[model samples]
Target: MPRLSGCAFFSDKIMQAKVDLLHTGAEAMFADLGHFSKKAIQIAFLSSIYPSLVLTYAGQTAYLINNVNDFSDGFYKFIPRPVYWPMFVIATLAAIVASQSLISATFSVIKQSVVLDYFPRVKVVHTSHQKEGEVYSPEINYILMVLCVGVILGFGGGKEIGNAFGVVVIMVMLITTIMLTLVMIIIWRTPPVFVGMFFIPFVIMEGSYVSAVFTKIPEGGWLPFAVSMILALIMFVWYYGRQRKIEYEMANKITMERLGQLLAMPEVQRVPGLCFFYSNIQDGLTPILGHYIKNMSSLHTVTIFVTLRYLLVSKVDQRERVLIKRLGPRGVYQCTVQYGYADNLSLKGGDDLVAQVMRCLKRHIAMSTDRRSSVSTEEEIANLEAASLAGVVHVRGKMRFYVGDDAGCFDKVMLRSYEFLHSICRSALPALGMPLQQRVEIGMLYKV
Candidate 1:
């Protein structure tokens, strides 16, 4: 949707309309309308109702030869071959471009959904050097190609394709209409009478179209339903399965007070430099950290507990980018990095993200050491430079899942699909834009 880019156009709607239409044939019509309200209604009618009426009339009067017949070959048969061939090439190119846009948009939504923890991840490779979100997915590209082939082979002709396309568009409209009605009551809290006035008729209109679309299922309409259902199942399984994993982690999570007490032990040696522990468990001690301590018997001089949190926003400002909370003593700190829906954590200048966290850590250390004193900007920058020179490393646990014999059918199915999809997705390490040598992965097993 152009909702993110249409702010200026919507802000000065009247001016926009004038510039687009005042010098054209609509200028005389606008003049005859006189007032803005009348002109607005006239423009809306011209754009929507008038066009539909004109199209219907044109189709009947110019193209239709009979009252009951609808044929896919009719239009091409009527047109001269010379004119038909030229127009066909042009339309084909336009359709190809339109299909490109649709596929890109779908992949964009899926990529963002993965970041938002609503879907399983896919391999997203940047195709554009200058644009942050210009990504290409091999998996999606091949899948779309196969589907396109299937569609071409399955459809009898343009009629079936048009039928399928119209059905999808109508179904989309119906879904949006229902969502708008809920938004009116839940988001805007609009009065029920007013909500009914705006939404009811539109919903009824779209619902009817959708009901009609359902009638075509026996005639090439079942493909979209099958595809959508399968995709929806995959998405639902990934989201709720991950949610269960998070719940499991939280249920067995070690509290901060206990973590601090463990760190305070005399035998816990502090090694030099920063060790970045990438974790999903935000507040508690992660199994990754527990496993590290159990094996190494020593801690880093500076421990950065990094948690990448994606916000519901499209883009976040640097001011609200990172939240650093110092947990008790022994160089332990939690650095929560916030990213927006459109943000690329692995893009160019990603080093600045880690540097920002380092700067925050330095500032926290200075403030805590002084008790009542504060860290100056100069001192913080100096500390960051120092820490950068010493060294920094990222540590993350790669979890392997298991369901016991007692697990029910639903649990087994969900977890099996979750692991299968998880294997295909790019793990957080490679997706994080960190140097390969600096990133360390430890294997972890979680039983459900």
Candidate 2:
């Protein structure tokens, strides 16, 4: 009776382990969605991969049933001896391809998060000129390689590694299902009954898998949980710190009245050349502008406040990419360069940005209907041409954020972590293709 009970318990464990391993293959099927179209992936999986997987699993089960002693390493044991070497080579190649796919997917996810301000800025290299989504981040790739090595060394075997992988796979599936349900209800306006119908079965199945995996926590499942929590905390700190910095800039923005007063100061000199002041806010002058005026007491001949805005769409029309608006002061304009998530920043530093801005300025001046304004088309055009002849200077603010003296320890630690990340991550200006000689950075401190 005791032997029978022990056998039953082992059978149950084997079944659950198989369930955990099977889901990983399903997850891998969609991992390279960034590299291929959804329709192509779905069609391939449904027609070829799914049937192949089903047959392979069925054959393995049959072999195991017939040769119970070969249950250990059944995958290899079931293979015919004559073709074992070929099968092993094919499996090794497949594993490499899968790893590459997952790496590409990781880069795509990180790029999207950076665009949406959920992650710190990193150097992203577009692997394909035609496909914007095909990206490779060296920093992330190195980190992943290190972590993979460490995990392999620490776990020392497939069983413990499988425990960790199973937990992560189940959790990801559960989260994805919940997100899909929310999208169906909120975005697609699907009926509640339909949403529930689509969600409940998956949740129940995944919940069972989750329970099975939780039992492996002491073995190796805790690794994924720890790593995920650390990453989530870093992302949270970055998002929180970014929001606070934007709020501080908006609150301390220079008003039109104050700008006018500063411009009217006799000590202030209007220097020749086109100066582009980078700003976060679209409407008013950034605090960096105010700081520049207070220190140098000089303004550019043609000052353009440039703001880059990224939209959620895949691409924006080239005709509607740049929006130029005349601000209160003469020779001062605001140019908003809009880009979609999939659009490339093709405007290089020297003549490209200048030409685009000039074209946009000319269009804006010609389209203006305001009669009270002092914009003379010919004179403004001449001044801009002369400024272009002189040179273009890009002014960017180097900002540092710190917590207040009265802040709690959590705030201090979070802000400090954000600062450290910001220090190490790639700067926004360098990515713009701006030349170091022409770029000017004004240091500023903010108590967020």
What number of clashing residue pairs does each candidate have, in the order they appear? Answer: 0, 0
lDDT of 2 by residue, 1-448 (tens): 9998756645575477556887585677687786888999999899988898898889899999999998769999988899999999998998888788888889999998987889999877776645678889999999999999999998899988888888888899889999999999889999999999999999987777777788889999899999989889989999988888888888999988889899999999999999989887886878988889989999998999998887656677878888988878888888998876566664475446557778888878777765335657777788888997898898999888767899998878888888898898887643667777788999888877
User: Best-fitting candidate, measured by TM-score?
Assistant: 2
Score every model by TM-score. 0.75, 0.91
Badly placed stretches (over 4 Å) of model 1 are: 1-60, 66-72, 80-82, 123-138, 154-159, 264-268, 311-320, 340-352, 368-391
Put down candidate 1 lDDT per residue, 372-439, tens digits, no spaces.
Answer: 22545466446445655678888888876778999899999988888888888777544667777787
* Residue 180 local lDDT, model 2: 99
Each candidate: what lDDT? 0.68, 0.83
Question: How much does candidate 1 score in TM-score?
Answer: 0.75
User: Candidate 2: where is the Cα deviation over 4 Å?
Assistant: 1-14, 128-132, 311-316, 340-351, 371-375
* CA shift of 296, model 1, Å: 3.0
